[model samples]
Target: MAVKTNCNINGIDYYRLRVTIGKDRKGKDVIKNFYGTSKTDAENQKDGWMKNKLLGINHISIRDSLSMAMFNWVWDVLKVSGIKVTSFERYEGIYRNYVEESSLGFMILEDIQRVNVQRCYNKLHEQGKSYSQIKNLHKVINMFFKYAVIEGYLLRNPCTGIKLDVYKKEEDVGEIDLFIEDEGTVETFTDEEIPVLLEGIKNKKLKIMVKFALGTGLRQGEILALKKTDIKNMVVQVTKTLSFAKLYDDADNYSYETIVTRPKTKKSIRKVPIPTELKKDLAELNKIRIEEKLKLGELYQDNDLLFPSETGTYIDSRNLLRSWKRAFEGIDVPYKKFHALRHTFATQLIKNGAQLITVSRLLGHASIKTTEIYAHVTESTKADDVQSLNSLFK
Candidate 1:
């Protein structure tokens, strides 16, 4: 016989399963026990004893407990906290791959010691993960142990003093200044290659979008958000952005959808000058829209998107990504992405000696510090400084 009960003991929650024998109305003895929660451990222990009588487990021994149940409870807590769906999914994967394989997964909560955590870190480090990755793993383990403490399964978290300082030094903290790709990093196109790329782009829209990204450093979303109304006389008001992401469940083999959202940050909301050269392209784009509207016997609405698909619908950014891949690959540039154009814009601005603050605003960076990464990526901006250093030798 077994029964279940829940109780809070000294500010910690616990479940008690117990068994006991009692006399029936017929004067026959029966046994039952259960697990339950109450205000105190004694009350919970009593409830568990009652539960044992009901379940008929006469020799029930609550010798050793499992920590797996407690770890699962912590997972539920994290899910309810609104962690990003993708991030939560990855966390679940980590639990299955790493935590479940570790011996600590089955240990009694009180038995989890610093050595247990250190062993887990050592195993992960041997698996070729970076120190940062190991550090994140530590955080997950620490959180589980803390939950154990709160659940009254353990007096204290045994992972408090686990040290991995020696492993931290093995991480390559050096500044890596290469454009990463699926395969590996490659040498990016130089400024001299820009003329060749411009010549290679045959599609007018592709050419315009590329130039816009390179000149204005607008994200694909910000560019997609542009409306005919957004383009006032000389200013391009960047109040909104168009983001393309895949929906969770779309059955029609559809892989992407466009959601009109605000820019990535409030600072990203600012006006940027429309380059004079872009005026001609904008005028042509507008003319095409007007002609399409006349063909359909409807006036072009004020809500007309600045960059629309061939059918006069809003363009899907996934299509734009595919187009970018095709366009850059066609030009024999080896590797160039939509973001690289933004990078090019920033690097070129810096090379031209634009102040960091001005460039930061142009790119809508939340902080000038983020814009500084571009300064590190491009060394051409320091050419003059190199010459200055060499001048002392002369």
Candidate 2:
């Protein structure tokens, strides 16, 4: 009978299958070991290899290494129990976009060399993927390999010790007259630029939404899911998040659905206090909504959402992007994302001397280290510093 043993290497667990294949020509019993991410895969590989050995057609069990492709990774994710629905969906999107479609993703787990992985990373960088996004890709890749190593799918993780650049663009953005380093870092609009941005946005609901994001730094889904009941005494309780998900019909037609889920993390459920101005804004907005409801009467769809689409449906991110772009039109400043508002808020607080721990707590981050990225100043601040040289020149 074939038996399995549990072992861990480099902190990753694996199952080893062992079997005796009779005596060799040297009069010694030949034992073979096959490894797998799962006992079933290991056992099957051992049996298959043993059968092929008798026919003098067996290789080094090279075929035992599974190909970590999009479809296969997805099945692995589904089989792994207790993953949050939102996390699973995010992982699915990452795989389909970066791995399953990339050249590196098509190779067998054993065959993916460091050079191949490096090439893929370079390609993503060349495609203008943000440093944070590339980091996210790397994180997903690391996760896949960690599971692969634990299950013994591969003898080792290919992502290990790959020499790569992080935030290499810093050199190009490093030139500055101020004490700050010269080079592009995290993007954000200056305090002055924010007013211009808010003023240019034509959509009233979106303007308030942007204000709420700047004030609280809440994620798009969290902002979209906000309700009247979630707020009290200027404190907003983040309870749920809503994201767009697609549904298929019997005939294979696709329609979009809103997948409402819990907050992203345990820390994400923290309460955020709003400024007094924002509280007044909310009150005024609520009165407007009440009037709207009374006017629309039977035509109104009342979900009690703080911000919803005109017809009271979930706001689509793509449509939100269009609104974001329109808000920047006729503005002389360089374009930044709607997300930059959150960044702007963080940087402004940092400039005014907010502690990193305080920022981390307000941002609902799991760790203080995650909030460290917001400590850097923007180029606009440096430009303002240069303007002060006029006084020194005199």
Candidate 3:
């Protein structure tokens, strides 16, 4: 009979079972330990082991080491967890890039400590990975350990106490000026730059896309996923987003496919009101689309997309971005990423005295904190108001 005993390690309570196998060559008993979160769990583990031994089957626990556990967890568990395809790819990428080849990954599950996880993050930071990247990596690793702990594979999550902030480095102000800025600093076209941008774009389709993005504050993916039926009564319903993901076949061959998935979050499914001016523009665009369909006469592949490729399939995001850059040719205004159009929409709203909460709902942000990035625009507006007061005093 296997002996089961209550045990505590690192403040975690569990049960340990000691089993005696056949004696060694020297007539000494061979002992093995199986651990679990409770006595019944330990007994079940021991029973399974005994059954495997009786059948002459070699059974290795996934919790034996970090790499083995992570591989199984990612492929066997997380892959089928109903997450978006892009999200699965991101987690797999982080494991391949940061964890699988690292020293901590090779460590035994029991030997992994908080310091080991912290060291991994420190190394990533030292390698010039951005704070956001490290933070995302931490999220994946933490979830991995948390799952282990819940399954009794680990006594506690080694990632629980790790501090990511300590690994963050202060940005150099000079470097910021030289390089393109991050989302922390929202960039948008000025009122003067808008007309210049519109007139400069050579492709009529790309021009309409830009105008729609500016007016509605929809993400590039959301705009690309739009169907003609998604708009009704001068409102656009943002229910889905288009994504391009690299996927692997059973034979390990990789290919890219365009997928239409639900909006990023529940809030992203809300409707956005279309401006009166953009409504007229869309009606005109619809007429042009009808003309193109008739001209193509069975050659066109109609997907009913509001904005589709020349043949009516999904537009490749890369091609759109490339065309966008070329659209700025010989133009006076500096080029910004397509996302800047959405940023500009939010900023313009804030400047026009729209309430922050209202703006947050309009933009479909999951949290108000995300919308608060544009609060600085309000501060700048306040400074202008102060200047007007100074003029009045004069």
Global lDDT of each candidate:
0.61, 0.67, 0.77
Q: List, residue by residue over 10-43, the lDDT tens digit for candidate 1.
A: 2434454434445554666543222233335435
Task: Give the TM-score (vs. native) of candidate 3.
Answer: 0.76
Q: How many backbone clashes does candidate 3 have?
A: 0
Models 1 onward score TM values of 0.58, 0.68, 0.76
**True-structure lDDT of candidate 1:** 0.61
Q: Please provide, for model 2 over 1-394, each residue's C-alpha lDDT reduced to its tens digit, 9 standing for 90 to 100.
A: 6445485533445576767867754567756555666688777877776676577543333344333333445554542656655566566667668875355653445766666777778788888875555666676787777766776666777778865456356633322211111112467887678788888877777778888888988877788888888898889999888877654331123466677788766887889888778876786677767776777788888888888666565677789988888877898667887767777777777877888788878877666655666764533576788899999879
Stretches of model 3 off by over 4 angstroms after superposition: 1-65, 167-185, 377-394
Error in Å for residue 312 of model 3: 1.3
Q: Which runs of model 1 end up more than 4 angstroms from their true locations?
A: 1-188, 246-256, 294-303, 329-332, 380-394
User: Who wins the lDDT comparison?
Assistant: 3
Evaluated at residue 228, the lDDT of candidate 2 is 81
Query: Per-residue alpha-carbon lDDT of model 3 for 1-394, expressed as tens digits?
Result: 6545486544555576677866754678766566666678777867876786698653346434465467667876888788888777778888878877566665557777888778778877888877767777788888998887788777888888788666555532111210112244568898899999999998878888999999899989999999999999989999999989866541134578999988767888999998988877897778768877888889999999999887788999999989999988899999898999998999889888899998888887877767776876556767886888877666
Any residue pairs clashing in model 3, and if so which? none
